[model samples]
Target: MKFLLTSGGISNDSIRNALVDLLGKPISESSALYIPTALYANPNGPAMAARLIRGETNTAPFPDGFTSMCELGWKSLGVLELTALPSIDEKCWLPLVKETDALLVEGGDPLYLCYWMRQSGLADLLPELGRETVYVGLSAGSMVMAPSIGEDFVGWKPPTGGDRTLGLVDFAMCPHLDHHDMPDNSMANAEKWAAGMPVPAYLIDDQTAIQVVDGVVDVISEGHWKLFTQE
Candidate 1:
């Protein structure tokens, strides 16, 4: 599966273009699944999820001040709540996932999202997806793919201890870098956070994204970002 991991959702033209390249078709022709399970672990999560589904951009938390993921026009968009999947038969949802062009995952709490992904059997299915499927992730959605999120970003802890995540990727990420709303997200704090990480980490602003095709990873950014290797 191809990955379009963003600190913020397709906030700029460059990121959108990269998404199109991944899709190999116009946005209008693509079908996507919006996973808002991560948002439920956050404060006002339900309201935020509603706003995303409705495609409302007003008072959006993103640095770009734009609707993060769900707003983009697509031929079809459906909500695949991870929490609900465990109760249903796999045959009901597995085909939908395999058939979709993309999965648009929202942000909130990475740990919570990670837990549900595992519980819902989605994590195990990821490796089986075809190359044509793009995974578009925003904030926590993107963070969940890393080896770990570090203690600084931990919120809803998993039942099993530790900051470890899916480890789908080799590195960690400190997203929303230097955003005014998140005062603790300064470069200094990011540096300190990276110090405890075993793998390299990317400090990325909202206008930045990490694109992974096969195993080749590339940074796609219109804003500032930095990559810190373990010392």
Candidate 2:
């Protein structure tokens, strides 16, 4: 399985071009799959919506975002609604992902996303997907792939308690490294968090990506890609 870790959304032309260069073809050639953990535009919506008596917008417009990602040349197959799966049967999911060529995980709160991933069986099934196809991960998507989410950026507060991730990748990744919009301490905090894991951590700046193919990870980018592996 191959993995692409981007610092942020594919909103920039350079980043998009870099993705094409790394993926080895246009997204149409790849079976694009997008995963969303949080979709609301409003930052405070989740907690606020939970308290509303009725008609609260618990779920945001996910398809719109999916379409946007596709416009960038991604063949977005579906957004795995981690929170909405218990009502469905499991036999229906594996085949869907197994057939895809690539899987994209969009950005959001890693902690909150991880919370839902555990609630659903998707976390357990991701490694299987990895072994079979390519995995493209953006912000939160990159974070969850790691052993733990880093504190380099703002994170979500769980409704109640903390949640553990599926532990697919050995290291934690902090996407959007050196993004002008992020606070200066983001990388430092992430590095500190990773120190305890005793595993390598990466700070990937925008327009940069880490490509993992057949278990061999190579840094591919047009900019700085920092790696912190404690020997």
Candidate 3:
């Protein structure tokens, strides 16, 4: 599966272009699934989830250039709540996933998202997805793709009790770098966070995103980003 791991949602033209390239079609012509399960694990999660699904943008305290994932105007957009999948039959949702052009996962808690992805069977099903299917992730959604989110980003602990994630990609990420809303995400802190990571890591602002296709990784940014490799 193709990956468009982003610090923010589709916030800039470059990121949008990368997403379209991954889709191999226009956004208006494609179908997508919005996975907002991660949001539920955050503070005021339910309210935030509602706003995100409703495509409400420019809300206060969300950083200057925050973008909503669902407002992109797709041919069709459906919500695939990972938390709800476990209670339902796989046959009912697996086909929906296979048919969608992309999965637009929202930000919240990375570990929480990882936990649900495993429990909902999505983690196990990822490798079987078609190569053309794009996985668009925002913040924690993107972080969950890494081998580990590092201890600093851990919020919701899974039963397994570790910062480990899906490991879909080789590197970990620190999103919203230097954004005033998140003082803890400053570069110095990101550098400290990267120092403890066993793999390479990225420190990206809202305008940046990392694109991975067929195992090749590229930085698609309208703002700034830094890739740190361990010594």
What overall lDDT goes with each candidate model? 0.91, 0.61, 0.92
Evaluation by lDDT, superior candidate among 2 and 3 = 3
Which tens-of-lDDT digit does each residue in 1-231 have in candidate 1?
999999988999999999999999999999999999999998889988998888876755653556557778899999999999999999989999999999999999999999999999999999889999999999999999999999999889888978888988888999999998889999999999998899999999999999999889999999999999975
Steric clashes per prediction: 0, 1, 0
Could you give candidate 3's per-residue lDDT for residues 168-217 as a string of tens digits?
99999999999987899999999999999999999999999999989999
Clashing pairs in 3: none
TM-score of 3: 0.98
Window of ten residues with lowest summed lDDT in model 2 = 58-67
lDDT tens digits, residue span 59-78, model 2? 32222112234345555566
Point out where model 3 deviates above 4 Å: 60-63
